[model samples]
Target: MSGHSKWNNIKRKKEKTDGQKAKIFTKIGRELAMAVREGGSGDPAVNSRLKDAIAKAKANNVPNDNIDRIIKKASGEGNSDAYEAIQYEGYGPSGVAVIVETLTDNRNRTAGDLRHYFDKFGGNLGTTGCVSFMFQKKGVIVIEAEGLDEDEVMEAALEAGASDFQSDGDVFEIFTEPEDFSAIRDELAGKYTFVSADVEQVPDTYTAITDPDLIVKMGRLLEMLEDNDDVQSVWHNWENADDAE
Candidate 1:
């Protein structure tokens, strides 16, 4: 598995704890709110972004009741939070490419915190397009491979419009074109339970850091970024990212 997928699998395990789960719920809630406001509708039938956000929330095991409540609150007149979507590109230890996606009410505060994190952990935040050109946006869906037949899963994914299928010993990953991600995910949803279902930045190439000190700093950098309330997703190109463990 790639670093992005591997980290997500690790995060999935971590989210089994109440504290981590609550943090994930809060992050997804912000995403839901942004979808509703930007898409201009609470109804998933009419709002594609909202539909994708709800699917992502459900895949993360968010309750149906909570989903409905969030949509309702977000669309209500009483809700006035104006979150802006921002993308930050940077390099981690040994030039490990990193991309962070955030939704924040205060741009300055978010930028400062992120800058501080990078500097504290032996990395530096870069200009908007610095590392982004190294990645491609793809819809990635992960399903537990246990008790599942590889051939069958591969066939189903290909038939459902997945561009590629891969198994990383623990889970099956299905890749889809950005434009076709939602449709492919919906098609496979009826038959398979997802560990993760979302469009993500996928690195075209990967790098590794061998120095132990740099490895620790890289791990801390990622940890702080993920724990930030404004950060929704973090993608990286570290092949030996498991070293962070």
Candidate 2:
């Protein structure tokens, strides 16, 4: 499996743990708020960010009523606080580069929490742009390949302007430029059922960390960062250990 796919699978497993679902909900809520604030419209048809947020919320089983209420509240002047999107760069265990994307009402609180997590996990949060250069922003869509032919899927994705395509087990992952995300997704709407689609910072190269102890520490640090209400996504360059079972 590719490093990106492996990390995604690990994230899926982590989300199944107790209390993590609530964190996921908070992140989605923040995303929805930001989308509404930026797009100036709550209608998904005119706001791609809002559309992606709603899709993610629905995928997570967030209730329709709650979604509508949030959108309504955001559209009006109802307690909708503007959130600033911040990106923090750092190094995790084994000197692996990591980038954290967060939407926060207070930058101080978010920065403090992030720095503490990195320090506690034997890593150091660096200045902005320190580690981001090692990665590229791309839109990734993962779909179930249970009954679909890999070749056919590849053809469609390529025709839709995908940069790369790969399969691991029964899942097919499609990568495209950030600008081409919506078009590619629309093109494949009726052709494939996607497991998930989101924009991510993909690492150009991976740092291999084989020690089990350090791997556990890195995982804990990542989990803590992800659980923060302000944190939207975390990207790292650590490769899955070959001995991981």
Top TM-score model: 1
**Model 2, position 11: C-alpha lDDT score:** 48
Residue runs of model 2 more than 4 Å from their true location after superposition: 5-18, 241-245
Candidate 1: regions farther than 4 A off: 1-8
Model 1, residue 218: displacement in angstroms? 0.5
Least well predicted 10-residue stretch by lDDT in candidate 2: 1-10
lDDT of each: 0.89, 0.82
TM-score of each: 0.95, 0.91
Residue 53 in candidate 2, Cα distance off native in Å: 1.9
Compared with the true structure, model 1 gives a TM-score of 0.95
Give the root-mean-square deviation of each candidate in angstroms: 1.7, 2.3
Give the top-scoring candidate (lDDT): 1
Task: Quantify how close model 1 is to the true structure by its C-alpha RMSD in Å.
Answer: 1.7
